[model samples]
Target chain A: MSLVEVTGLTKVFRRPVKDPGFRGALRHLVSPRYRDVTAVERVDLRIEPGEAVAYVGPNGAGKSTTVKLLTGIIVPTSGEVRVAGLSPHRDRIANARQVGVLFGQRSQLWWDLPVRESFTLLRDMYGVPDSLYRARMKRFDEVLDLGSILPVVARKLSLGQRMRADLAAALLHGPRIAYLDEPTIGLDIAVRDRVREFLRQLRDEGTTIMLTTHDLGDIEDVCERLVIIDRGRVIYDGSLAAVKDDFARERRIHLQLASPVPLASLSDRLPDAVVVAGDEPGEFTVTVDRFRQTAGAVISAVLPLAEVVELRIDEPAIEDVIRKVYAGELRLA
Target chain B: MMEYEADFWLLVLAGLLQQLVGLAFLGAVFAQVQALHGWTFTEAVLLYGFASFVFGMSPLFFDGLWRTAWLVNQGDLDYALVRPYPVMLQVSGSYVGLQGAGDVVVATCMIGWALSRADISWSPLTVLVGAVLLVSAVTIRVSVLAASCAISFWLQAPHSGFAFAINQLGTLGRYPLTIFGVALRGVLTVVIPFAFTAYFPVSWLLDPGRYWWAAIVTPLVAAYSLILGVRIYHRGVRRYESAGH
Candidate 1:
C-alpha cells in the first residue's frame, strides 16, 4: 500500500475584504466582508515507500499548502489525506512521529536556544531513545558538520549553517517519511551539493521522501520521479528520465570547421537537422532530434563536407523544459 | 533574559514597584473607612494578595501563551503543530516572564503577613484546604488567560487586543465583590470569572459560616475554566490558515 495517499484534497481560505486606507478600515470594522480564495483544488497524489518524488511548481502554485495539509499543519476544506493509513489531521501526533518535515524558509530551532538544546528538546518531545539519538547525532555531525554550530544560538547562525542544522533536526528521529520544502534555497553551490548528497543517501536507506523545490538540479540529482504543479493542479507526473525523453528530445551540436564552408552544403547534407551559420566563417550549429539521428551521424555528415576543427555537443536539460512551462511557452497539460 | 542582566533586573524592580503601589492605594482607601462593605483591612489585603499572586503565575511560567497572537499572525505556530506534542503546552512554555518572579515574591509576603494579623481558627485541615484553594485559584486565572488569548486565531492581528482588555478586568478581582453593582458583579463572577481567582476563595477562608459553599464552587469553576480553555484553543487551531512566508 502507498505510504501517503491524498484524494481530491482542497483548501479554501476566507480573507476579510478591506480597502487600502484608514477610511476603508473603518468601513470594514462596521460591516465586515470576506472573500473565499482557493489555494489547493482537487489535487490527488500517492507515494510508495522508498520513493523520492520531487514536487515542483511556480510561486503561489499551492505546493506549500499541499505540504501543510499532508503534515497536518492545516486542514483541507474538502477531500482526504492519509499518511500511514491514518488521517494526518485526525491522527496528527501519530503521523508526526512517523514523518520528518523541514521548511527552508523557516527554522524549527528555538530562536533563543542553542542548536544542541533544540535537538535535545525535540528528542524528549518525540521520545527518541538514547542509543538511537546518539547514533543519529553522530551521523548528522559527519554529513552536516553540526559540531561547529551545535553550541551557537539559532538566531546567530548564518543561512547555510542554519539550513544544515535544521536538516539534521528534521531527520534526527529517522522518520519513515521526510517532507522537505525548498531545503536548499539560497545556498551556495557547495552547500547545495552537500544537501543533495545527504538526501540521496537518505533515499538509499529506504526512507520515503517528498521534496518540493524550485531548483531543477535538486530534482535531477536527488529524485527519481517528478510531479509538476501549476495553479494548484498537477499538470505533469512521471519519471524524471521520461519527462526529459518526451519533451527535451532536441540536442544541439556546435562545430567549427578547419576552413570556411558553405552553410547551404551542410544543411543539404544533413536534411534531418537544422544547420545555422555562426558569427565566424567556419562556425555552424546543428540542431537534431536525438531519437531520429545521433550526434555521430551529424558529425560524420559534417566531416565529409568540411574538416572538423572543434565540436561540442549539448544534451537537452529538464531545466529548459520546466522554465518554458513556467513562462507559459510550453504547455504540459 | 540571561544575556541582558540589566534589563531583567529593571523589569523585576518595575513589577515589584507596581505591586507596592497597589498595596499603598489599598491602605489609603481603608484609612478613609474602617471596613469597606463589611470586609476588614486585613481581609481586603488577603484578597488583593491572592489576585496578585494568581496574576503573577502567567508572567513567571505561562507567559508564552501571551505570544499566541504573534505566533498565529506570523504563522510561527507551524512547527509546533507538526511536532509530536500538544501545541498548547508548547506555546504556554515557550517563554518565561522575568517580572513575574518579583510579583510572586511580594504577593507571597503579603499573604503571610495578612494570615498572621487576621483572626481565624487554625487547624491542619484548614491549612491543607487553603493550599488546594490557592492552587485552584491559579488554575482558574491561567485558564481564563489562555482562553482569551485564543481569540487571536480569529482576529488575525499581531497583538492580543481582546486578551489585553480581558486581563485589565482581572485588576478588579483584587477588591471585594460587594463594592460593585450587581451587573459588574455578575460580569466578574460568571462572564470572565476573575472573582474565583481571589474573591470567592479568600471569602471562604475568611468567613466560612456564610461562604462555606465557595470552597466547593472554586474547584468546580477551575475545572470548567480549564476545559473551556483547552477546547477553545484546539478549536482555534483548526481554523489556522498558516500565513504565507
Candidate 2:
C-alpha cells in the first residue's frame, strides 16, 4: 500500500510576487500586492510503504515547499495530500504523529538546552512512553553515535552534530514515515556518511523515507528510488540507478601523487581528466565522459603521470543532474 | 508524562532573578522620591511593581505572545499544529521572554513599598480586589498581543506594527489613564481597553475613594480580551496559508 499520496498539489506564494521598483513597493502595501508564484504545480506522487525515495531538485525548485506541504506546516492552495491514509493538512496532528521530519537549515531543538533535553521535549510532545523513548535513543546512539554529542547544548553543537540530534528527535516517537530535507547539507563527508548510514538503517527496518538533498551521495548510499522535481513539478520518478545511468553519463577520476606535481604539466599528461581544484600538488581531478570512454580506459591513460598513491572514481553526482534538469537539459520522460 | 518540566521551571526561575534586578533599580529611585507624582513612594512603587509582575508573569506563563511573530515567520507553528497538543498551549510553551524576571520583582516591591507608606492601610477587601484585578489585567494585556500576532500570519510585516501598537497602548496603561484626558481615556477604556489593564485596576486598587467602578471592571476586561483574542486567533488560522508551499 502507498503510505504517501498526493494529487495535483499546487501552492502559490502571494507574498513576494510584485512589479519591480519603489513605485510597485508603495502600491503593494496599499492594494496588498499578491504574486501567484506556483511553487508546487500539479504535483502527483505516490510512495509505497517501506520505500526509500530520494526527492532532489535545484535551489528555488520547490523542494522545501513540497516538504512543507507534505509535513502540513502550510495548507495547500489546491490539491489533496495524504500520509498514512490521513490528509496531512486536514488531520495535520494525526499525520504528524506518524511522520518524522528534519530540515537541515534550521533546527527544532531549543538553543540553550542540551541535546538530550531536546530529545526529551520531543518525546513529551510526541507523547512517547519512557521505555520506548529510551529504546529509540539507545538505537539512535548506536547508529548515529549520538552519545558523544548528547551532553552539548543545541547552539553549541556542530552543524553535523545538530543534524544528527535532529534526526533522533524526529524519530523519538517511532514514526512510520520520515522526511529528511538536506540532512547532510554543509557537513563534512565523514559526518554526511554517518547520517547516511543511520538513514540506511531506517530504510532496512521498513520505514518509508522521503529524502530531499543536493548531496548525490545521500541518494546513492540510501535510496533505491529517485523523484526529481524541477520548476515545481516532478520530472522523473523511478529507480535511482536508472536516473544515474540516464542523465549522469559522465565519471570523474582522482589521482593522488607521492610527490608535488605542477598543474600545467599534469594537464598536458592527462588531457582526458580536467585538473579540478585540489589541496596541494598531491591531488588532481580528471572528469571523463563515460559515453566517450570508460573508467578503466581513463585510469590507464593517467597511471604513468602520478605515482598514483590513491585513485578514486566519482560517479556522476546528482547535483549536476539536478542542475541540468533545472536548466531544461534533462526533462522528465 | 507529557510535561516540559525543565523548560517550565527554568522560565520561572529566570524570571524571578530578572524581577529582582528590576526591583533593585526601582528601590534606588524610591529612596529619593519618598513619593512619586501624588501617592507616597510606596503606592507608586506598588503600581510599578504590579506592572512588572504582570509583564514577567505573562511572558513566563504565556510565552505565545512574545514568540508568535517569530514562530509564524519560521513556520514553527506547523510543528505545533501537527502535534496532538492544543495549538495555543504549544505556542505558549515555545518561548518565554528572559527579561520577564526583571519586571516581576520591581512590580512586587513597588506594591510593598506603597503599602508600607500608605497613610491608611489597605483593607483586606481592597487587597482581595487588587489581586483579582491584577490577574485579570495580565490576561487582557497578553491577549491583545496574542491576537495581534495571530493576525500576523496574514500580515506581511507585523513585527513593527505589532510592537508600536502594543507599546502605544502601553502608554495608556503605564501612566495614569486619566493623564490622557477624558476623551482619549474613553477611546482606550472602550475601543482598545488596554487602558483598563493597568489604569482602571490600579486606580480601583489604590484609590478606591475616587474610582469605585474599577473593582467591577477587572473581571469584565479580562473575560472580554481573552475571549476576543482567542476568537480572533482562530479566525486568522483559517486565513493562514503556509510559508512558501
Candidate 3:
C-alpha cells in the first residue's frame, strides 16, 4: 500500500466579500457577502514509501493548499487524504507523528526563544527518545552546521541560518514522510545547494519526500518524480527524465566562426535544426531536438562549414518548461 | 520574556498600579458610606480580588490565546497544527505574560487581607469549598477568553477586538451584581458568564444562605465554559483557510 494517498480531494474557501470605503464597510456590517474559491478540486495522488516527488506550480496554483491538506493543517471541503493509513484530518495527531512539515515562508521556531529551545520543545512534543534525539542533533549539526545558531534567538538568525534551524526542527522526530514546501525559497546559492544536498541525503535514508518548490535546481538535484499542478489540478505526473525527454528536448548550440559565413549554407547542411543568425556575422545558433540530433553532431556539422573559435550549448532548462506550462502554452497530455 | 526585562517590569507595574487605584476607589467609596447595596468594603474587595486573580491567571499561563487573531491572520498557526500535541494547548502555551505576575501578587494580597477582615466561619469543609470555588473561577475566566478569542478564526482581524470587548466585560465582575440592572446581571450570569469567575462564588462564600446554589453552580458553569471554549476553538480551526504561500 502507498504511504500517502489522496483521492478526489477538494478544498473550497468561502472568502468574505467586502466593498470599498466606509459606506461599503457599513453596508457589510449589516449583511456580509462571501464567494467560494475552489483552491483544490478533485485531485488524486498516491505516493509509495521512499519516493521523492517534486510538486511544482505557479503562485496560487493550489500547491500549498494541497500540502496543507496532506499535512492536516487544514481540512478539505470534500474528499479523502490518508498519510500512513491514518486519515490526515480525522486523526491529525496520529498522522502528525508520521510526517514532518516545513513551510519555507514561515518559521516553526519560537520567535523570542533560542533555537535550541525550539528544538528541545519539538523533541519533547514528538516524544523522541533522548539517545536518538542527541544522535539526530549531532547529525544535523554535521550537515546543517546548526551549532553556531543553536544559542542564537530565532529572530536574530539570518535567513540561511533560520532555514537550517527550521529544517532541523521539522525533522527532529525522524518522521517517515517530510512535506517541505519551498524549503529553498529565498536562500543564497550556497545555502540552497546545502539544503538540496540535505534533502537528497534524507531521501536516501528511505524517507518519503513531497517537495513543493519553484526552484528548478531543487527538482533536478533532489527529485526523481515530477508532479506539475496548475489551477488546482495536476497537469502532469511522470518521471523527471520522461518529462525532459518529451517536453524539454529543445537544445541550442551557439557557435562563433573565425570568419563571416552565409546563413543559407549552414541552413542547407542542418535541415532538421533551425539555424538562426547571432549578433555578429561570424556567430550563429543551431536549435536542435536532442532525439533527432546531438549537440556534438551540430558542432561537427558546423566545424566543417567554418573554423570554430568559440562554442557553447544552451541546455534545455526545466524552468522554461514549467513557465510554458504555467502560461498555458504547453499541453502535457 | 526576560529578553525585554524593562517592558516586562513596566507592564507588571501598570497592572499593580491599576489594581491599587481600584482599591483606593473602593476605600474612598466605603469612607463615604458604611456599604454600597448592603455589601461592606471588605466584601467588595474580596469580590474585586477574585476577579483580578482569575484575570491574572490567563496572562500567566494562557496569554497565548490573546494572539489567536494575529496568528490566524498571518497563518502562523500552521506550524502548531502540524505538531503532534493538541493545537489548543500549543496555542495557549505559545506565550507567557510576565506582567501578570504583578496582578497575581496584588490580588493575592487583597484576597488574604479581605478574608482575614471579613466575617466567615473557620472549618475544613469551608476551606475545601473555597479552594474548589477559587479554581473554578480561574477556569471560567480562561475558558471564556479562549472561546472569545477563537472568534478570530472567522473574523480575520489582526487584533482580537471581539475577545477584547469580552474581556472588558470582566471588569463588571469586580463589582456587585446587585448594583447592575437585571438584563446585564443576566448577561454576566448566563450569556458570557463573567459572574461565575468572581461575583457568584464570592457572594456564595460571604452569605451561603442567600446564594447557596452558587457553590454547585460555579463548578458546573466552569465545566460548561471549558466545553464551550474547546468546542468553539476546534470548530474554528477546522474552518481556518491558511494564508497565501
Candidate 4:
C-alpha cells in the first residue's frame, strides 16, 4: 500500500468582495458579498515508502494549499487524504506522529525563544523520549552543524541558519514521512548544497520525502520522481530521467572554428541538425536530436567546411523540460 | 526572558500603580458618602479587590488568548494545529504575562485591609468557603476572556477587539450590583456573569444570611463558563482558514 494517498482533493477559498472607497466600505458593511476561488481542484497523488517526489509549480498554483491539507493544517473541501491509513484532518494526532513538515517561507521556531529551547519544547510536545531526543539532536548537530547556533534566538539567526534549525526541529521525532516545501530557497550555493546533501541522506535512510521547490538542483540531487503542477492541476508526473528523456531530447553543440563559416553552408551540410551563428564570427552552434543524430556525426559534417579549434556539447537538463512546460511550448500527458 | 527581567518588573509595577490609583478614587468616593448602594465602604473595596484579583489571574496563565487575532491573521496557528496536544491549551500556554504579579499583590493587600475593617466573624468554615469562591471567581474570569478572544478566528483581525471590549466590562464589577439599573444588573449576573467574579461572591461573604445562595452557585457558574469557552474555541478552530494562499 502507498504510504500517502490523496484522491480527488480540492480546496475552494472564499474571499469577501468589497468595492473601493469609504462609501463602498460602508455599503459593504450593510450588505456583504463574497466570491469563491478554487485553489485546488480534484488532484490525485500517491507516494510509496522510501520514495522522494519533487512537487514543483509556479506561484499561486496551490502547492502550499495541498501541503497544508496533507499536514492537517487546513481541511480539504472535498475528496480524501490518508497518511499511514489514517485521515490527517480527522485523526490529526496520529497523523502528526507519522509526518514531519517544513515550510521554507515560514519558520516554526518560537520567535522569542532560542533554538535549543524551541527544540526542547517540540520534544516535549511530541512526547519524544529523552534518550531518543538526545540521539537525534546529536545526529542533527553532526550533519547540520547545529551546535554553533543552538543558543541564538530564532529572530536573530540568518536565513541559512534558521533553515538548518527548522530542519532539525521538523525531524526531531523521527517521522516516517517528511514534507519539505522550498527547503533550499534563498540560500547561497554552499548552504543549498548542504541542505540538498542532508535531504539525500534522509531519503537514503528510508524516509519518504515530498519536496516542493523551484530550484531544479534540489530535485536532481534528492528526488527520483517529478510532479509538475500548473494552475492547480498536475500537468506532468513521472520519473526525473523520463521527463528529461521524453521532453528534453534536443542537445546543443557549440564549435569554435579557426575561420569564419557561412551559417547557410553549415545548415546545408548537416541537414538533420539546426545550425545557428554563435557569439563570434568564427563560432557556430548546431542543435540536434540526440536519438536522430550523434555529436560525432555533426562534428564530422562540420569539420570539412571549417577547421575546428574547440567544441563543446551540452545535454538538455530537467530545467529545460520544466521551462518548456511552463511556457506552454510543450504539453505532457 | 532573562534579558527582559527589568522590563517585566516595570510592567508589574505599572499594573500595581494603576490599581492603586483606582483604589484611591474609590476611597475619595467613600469619604463623600456613607455608602454607594446599601453596601459599606469596606464592602465595596472587597468587591473591587476581588474583581481585580480574578482579572489579574487571567493574564498570568491564559495571556496567549490575547494573541489569537495575530496568530489567526498570520497563519502561525498552523504549527499548533499539527501538534499532539489540544490546540487551546497550546495557545493559552504560549505566553506568560508577568504584570499579573503586581495585580495579584495589590489585590491581596486591598482584600486584607477590607476584611479587617468589615464586621464579619472568622471561622474555619468561612475560610474554606472563601477559598472556594476565590477559585471559582478566577476560573470564571479566565474562561470569559478566553471565549471572547476566540472570536478572532471569525473576525480574522490581528488584535482581539472583542476581547478588549469584554475586558472593559470588568470595571462594572468593581461596584455593588444594587447601584446599576435592573437591566444592567441582569446583564452582569446572567448575560456575561461578571457579577459572579466579584459582586455575588463578595456579597455572599459579607452577609451570608441574605446571599448564601450566591456562594453555593459560584461553582456552577465557573463550570458553565469553562464549558462555553472550550466549546467556542473548538468551533472557532474548525472555522480557521490559514491567512494566505
Candidate 5:
C-alpha cells in the first residue's frame, strides 16, 4: 500500500480585500471584504513507501501551501489528503505520531532552552522509550556531531548547527515519513553535505521523505522523484534525470583551453557544434547534440586545435528548467 | 497531576524576598506610632503574605501567560488550537519560570509569623476553605492576563502593551480592593476583574463575608474569560501570517 495518497488535493485561502488608507479601513470596519487566494489548486500526487520525492517551485508557487495542507497545519478548502490511510486533519494526533515535520526558517526547538533540554522534552512529548531515546541520541551524535552543540542554547547556534540539531530532533520519534522544507537553506557547503548525507541515510532506512528547496545540488544529490508546481498547480512530476533532460535534446559542453583562441577559428574547427557563448581566455562554450556527438568525441576533436588544459560538462541547471516550468512551457516528463 | 517542584521552588523564593522589603517599609513607619488599622503590625504581615502567595502561585504554575506574546509573534498558537486540552491550560503549562517559585516560600514563612502575633483564629475547615479560594484566585488572574494576550493578537500592537497591563494589574492587586471608591471598585470587579483574582477571594476567606459565593464564582468567571480568549485565538490563526507565507 502507498504510504501517502493525495488525489485532487486543493486548498484555498480567503484573504481580506479591503483597500488602503484610513477611509477604506474605516469602511472595512463596518463590513469587511475578502479575496480568494488559491494557494494549492487541484494537485494530484502519490507516493509509495520509502520514496524520496522532491517538491520544487518558485516563490508563491504553492509549494509551502501544499505542505501545510499535507501536514495538517491548515485545513484544505476541498479534496482529499491521506497519509498512511488517515486524513491528516481528522486524526492529527494519530497522524502526527506517524510523521515528522520541520520548517527550517522556523524552529521546533525551544528558543531560550539548551538544545539537549529541548530534545529531552521531545522524548517525553513523543513518548520515546528511554533505551530508544539513548540509542537515537548516540546515533545522532555520530552523524551530526550533536555532542559539542548540545549544551548551547538554540538562539546561540549558527544556522548550520541549528539545522543539524533540528534534523535529529525530528527523527527521534521514529516516524515513518518526514517533511523537510528548505532544510539546507543558508548553510555552508560542508554543513549542507552532512545534512544531505543524513537524509540519504534516512531514505535508505525506508523512510518516505518529502522535500522543498531552491538548491539544485540538493535536488541532484538527495531526491529520487520530482514534483514541480507553478502558481498553485503541478506542472511536472517524474525522475530527477528525466526532469533535467526534458527541456532540451542536447547538452552544452564548455571547453577551457590553455591559451587564447579566436572565436572564428574555434567555430570553423567544429562547424556542426556552435561557439554559442564564452568570455574568458582559453574558454569556449560549445553546443552539440549528444545524439550526434559524444563528449569524448568532441573533446578528442577540440583538443588538437587548442591546448586543452581542463574539460567540464555544462548541462542545463535545475534553476533554468524551473524558470521555464513557471513560464508554462514545460510539462510532465 | 503535574508537580513541577523544581520550578515551584524558584518562584516561591523570589516572592518571599520581594515581600520582605514591603514588610520593612511598613515597619519603619509603624515604629514611630502604634497601629494604623484596627489590628496591630502583625495583621499587616498577614495581608502581605496573602498577596505574595497568590502572585507567586499564579506565575509559577501558569507562567506561559508571559510567553503569549512570543507565541503571537512566532505563530506558535496554531499548534495549541488543534490539541484536545483546554487552550488556556496549554498556554499556562507551556512554560515554568523557576524564579517565581522562590517567592512562595517567603510568603509561607511570613504567614507563620503573622499568626504568632495577630489575634486570629484558624480551624481546619476554615484553613481548607481559604486554601481552596486561593487556588481559584490563581486561575482567575492567569485567565485575565491570557485573555489580554489573546485580544492583542488581532490588534497587531506589540505584545508589550498586554505585558505592561498584566504587571500593572498585579501591582494594583497587591493592595486591598475595598479601600478604593465605587468607580475603581466597579472597574476592578467588571471591566478587568483583578479583584476577584486576589481581593474578593482572600477577603471572603479571611473575613468570611456575606458574599461567600465570590469564592465559588471566581473560577466560573475565569472560565468565561478563557472561552472568550480562545475565540480570539482561533480567529487570529485564520489570519496569521505564518513564516514566509
Candidate 6:
C-alpha cells in the first residue's frame, strides 16, 4: 500500500469580507460579512514508500495548504487523507509518529532554548531512545556541521544555522515519511547544497519524502517524481526525466570560429537549426531540437563554413521548462 | 526555563511589591471601618490573599495559555498541531511566569498571618479540608483563565483581549460578594464563577455554620471549571484555521 494517499481533498476558508478603514471596521463589528475562499480544490495524490516526489507550484498555488492538510495542521473541508493507513486528522498522534515535517518559513525550535536543548526536548517529546538519538545527532553533525551552532540559542542563530537546527529537530525521531516545504528557501547556495545532500541521503535510506519547493535544483538533485500545482489544482504529475524530455527538448550550441564568419553563411550551412549572432564577431549561437538534430550534426555542418576554434553545448535545464510553465509561456496537462 | 533568569526575579519582585501595595490598601479600608457586612478585617484579608495566591499560581504553570491568541494569529500553532502530544497541554505548558512566585509568597504570608490573628478553632481534619479547598480555588482560577483565553481562537486576534477582561473581573472576587449588587453577584456565581476562587472557600473557613456548603461544593465547582476549560480549549483548537497561506 502507498504510504501517503489523498483523495478529492478540498479546503475552503471562510474569510471575513470587510469594507475600507475605521468606519468599515465599526460596521463589521455590528454586522460581519464573510466569503468562501477555496484554498485547495479536489486534489488527489498517492506516494509509495521510498519515493521522493517534488511538489512544486507558484506562490498561492496551495502547496503549503496541501502540506497542512496532509500533516493534520488543518482539517479538510471534504475528502480524506491517510498516511501509513491511518487518517492524519483523526489519529494525529499515531500519524505524527510516522511523519516528520519542516517548514522553511517557520521554525519549530523553542525560541529561547539552545539548539542542543531544543533537540533534547524533541527527543523526549517523541520518545526517541538514547541510542538512536545519539546516532542521529552524530550523523546530522557530520553532514550538516551542527557542532558549532548547537550551543547557540535558536533566536541568535543566523538563517542558515537555524534551518540546519530545525532540520535536525524535525528528523530526530527518524520518521518513515518526511514532508519538507521549501526547506532550502532563503538559504545560501552552500547551505542549500548541504540540505539537498541531506535530503538525498534521507531518500536513499528508504524514507518516503514529499518535497514542496520552487528550487528546480532541489527537484533535480533529490526527487525522482514531479508534481506541479497551479491555482489550487495539479496541472502536471509525472517523472522528472519525463518533464525534461517532453518540455525541454530545445538545446543551444555555442561556437567560436577561428575566422570571422557572416551570420548568413552559418544560417545557410545549418538550415534545420536557428542560427543567431553571438557576443563577439567570430562567435555564433545555434539553437537545435535534439530529437531532430544532434550537436555533432550541427557542429559538422558549421565546421565547413569556418575554422572552428572552440565549441560548447548548452543542454536545456529543467528550470527553464518549469519557468516557462510558471510564466504561461508553456502549458502542460 | 532558566533562559529568563534575571527577568524572572525582577518580575517576581515587582509582583511582590504590587501585592504589598494591595495589602496596604486593604489596611486603609479597614482603618476607616471596623467591619464591613459582618466580615472582620482578618476575614477580608484572607479572601484577598486566596484570590491573589491563585492568580499568582496560575502563571507559574499555565502562563502559556496567555499566548494562545498570538500563536493562533501568527500560525505558530502549526508546530504544536503536528506534535505527538495534546495541543492544549503543549500550549499551556509552553512558558512559566516568574511573577507568579511573588504572588504566591505574598499571598501565603497574608493567609498565614490572618489565620494566626483571627479567633478560629483549628483541627487536623479542618486543616486538611482547608488545604484541599485552597487547591480547588487555584484550579478554578487557572481553568477559568484558560477557558477565557481560548476565546481567542474564535476572535482570531493576536492578543487575548477577552481573557484580559475576564482577569480584570476576577479582581472583584478579592472583596466580599455582598459588596456587589445582585446582577454582578449572580455573574460571579453562575456566569464565570470568580466568587468560588476566593469568597466561597474563605467564607466557609471563617464561618462554617452558615457557609459549610460552600466548602463542600468548592471541589465540585473546581471540577466543573476544569472540564469546561479543557472542553472549550479543544473545541477552539478544532476550529483553528491557521493563519497565512
Each prediction's total of clashing residue pairs, residues at least 3 apart in sequence or on different chains, is 0, 18, 0, 0, 22, 0
lDDT of 6 by residue, A164-188 (tens): 9999898999999999999999999
Kindly list the per-residue Cα lDDT of model 3 for residues A1-333, writing each as its tens digit. Answer: 999889999999877788989988999889989898998989999999999999998899999999999999999889999888899878989988989999999999999999999999999999999999999999999899999999999999999999999999999999999999999988999999899989999999999999999899999999999998888998899999988889999998989999888999999989999999999988998999999998888878888878999989988988888889989899998
Tell me the whole-model lDDT of each prediction, alpha carbons only. 0.91, 0.76, 0.91, 0.90, 0.75, 0.91
lDDT of 1 by residue, B1-245 (tens): 46568878987898899999999999999999999898999999988988899898778889999999999999999889889998899999998888888898899889989999988888897888788888888888899889999999988799998999998999999999999999999999999899999999898888877888988999999999999999999999988888882
What tens digits encode model 3's per-residue C-alpha lDDT throughout B40-94? 9989999998889988888999999999999999988898889889888999998
The global Cα lDDT (0 to 1) of model 4 is: 0.90
What class would a CAPRI assessor give candidate 2's docking? Answer: acceptable
Between prediction 1 and prediction 5, the one with superior lDDT is 1
- lDDT per residue for candidate 4 within B1-245, as digits (tens), equals 44478888897998899899989999999999998888888888888898889878888888888988899999988888877878888888888887787888999888999999999978898899899999999888888888999999889989887899988887798888888899989988898889899888888888888988987899899999999999998888877898667
- What TM-score would every model get versus the actual structure? 0.98, 0.74, 0.95, 0.94, 0.77, 0.95
**How displaced is residue B116 in candidate 2, in Å?**
6.0
Per-residue CA lDDT of model 2 for B1-245, tens digit only, reads 11456665576577667656655665687688665456555555566566666666776667655566666665666556656666777777666665465456556666676667765446788778877998898888778767876767666343636744764565345554544677877877787777767767776766688788888877888898899988887666545554544
lDDT by residue for model 4 over A229-309, one digit each (tens)?
888888888999998888889999999999998899889999888888988998988899998999989989988988899
Selected candidate, larger lDDT, 1 vs 4: 1
Model 3 pairs in collision:
none
Chain A TM-scores in order: 0.98, 0.79, 0.97, 0.97, 0.90, 0.97
TM-score of candidate 5 versus the correct structure, residues matched by position: 0.77
Candidate 6: tens digits of C-alpha lDDT, residues B1-245: 78887897898998899899999999999999999898899988988888999899988999999999999888899989889999988998899888889999999999988989987778886799788888998888888988998999898889887899998999899999999999999999998889999999888788778888987899999999999999999888878888777
lDDT-wise, the better of 2 and 5 is 2
Give one digit per residue, the lDDT tens place, for model 1 in A1-333: 899999999988887899989999999999999998888889999999999999998999999999999999999999999998989888989988999999999999999888999999999999999999999999888887889999998999999999999999999889999999999999999889889989999999999999999999999999999999888888898899999899999999999999998988888999999999999999999999999999999988888777999999999999989999999899875
Candidates 5 and 6 compared: the better one by DockQ is 6
Tell me how far the alpha carbon of residue A269 in candidate 5 is from the true structure, in angstroms, after superposition. Answer: 12
Better of 2 and 4 by DockQ: 4
Question: What is the lDDT for B217 in model 2?
Answer: 72
lDDT of 5 by residue, A1-333 (tens): 688888888877666777789888898889989888888899999998899999998888888778877877677778899999988776767777888887777677777788998898778877899999999999989889999999998889999899999999888888899888899999999999999989898999999999999887887788888898888988788888776666654668878888888888778777778785477887888888766777887888777777788777876667677767767676654
- Score candidate 6 by lDDT: 0.91
lDDT of model 6 at position B215: 79
Any idea what lDDT model 3 has? 0.91
Q: What is the TM-score of chain B in candidate 3?
A: 0.97
Candidate 6 off by > 4 Å: A23-31, A260-271, A279-282
